[model samples]
Target: MSKMLTYDACVERIEQLREKMIVTAAQKGMHDPLVLQYSQELDRAHNYILFLQSLNIDNLSKT
Candidate 1:
């Protein structure tokens, strides 16, 4: 089973995966449709995760 990670750690891991995907896409030529789609999806996921993290911080501040 995978170990649970903190928010910051999860963000870092996502960033690393994003970078690897970018590099792989570049090597394969960014013009590939699947590569472009995957990149966009990853960007959306990262943004959503960051937004969630921000909300958590805001909630903590209110308490």
Candidate 2:
């Protein structure tokens, strides 16, 4: 089974992806396919964090 990531772990992953994407963009150019792939991955990570935050807000509202 897959394990869920903690908020801190998610943030760390986003940071790691951002750094890798930056390096890749610099070496391969911003339009490179690899860079684009990294960017998409980063976007998904950010979206996941946002989704988690929304869940927390929903729980707070119910409390």
Candidate 3:
């Protein structure tokens, strides 16, 4: 079985994915649907980061 990824690893992967998406979109001169989809995904990643930060805050309060 595969081990679960740490939070830092997940964030790093998301960053790499975002970078790849940006580069590909720019290279292909993509517009409309593809661009919109990537932008939405990037936004979702940002939201995930915010959620993680909130969890950190909760952890700090418990300590």
| TM-scores, one per candidate | 0.58, 0.89, 0.66
lDDT of 3 by residue, 1-63 (tens): 033445686588678768867887887766756766777766766667777788889999999
The 10-residue segment with the lowest total lDDT in model 1: 1-10
lDDT (Cα, tens digit) per residue for candidate 1, span 1-63:
045556676677678768867887878877877677667756766766777789899999999
Residues 1-63, model 2: lDDT tens digits: 034677788899899999999999999899999989889988988888888899999999999
The 10 consecutive residues of candidate 2 with the worst lDDT sum are 1-10
Candidate 1: residue pairs that collide: none
Predicted model with the maximum lDDT: 2
Look at candidate 3 and give me any clashing residue pairs: none
- Candidate 2 stretches with Cα past 4 Å from truth are 1-3
Model 2 local distance difference test score:
0.86
- Candidate 3: clashing residue pairs, number: 0
lDDT, each prediction: 0.72, 0.86, 0.71
For model 3, state the Cα shift of residue 51 in Å.
0.4
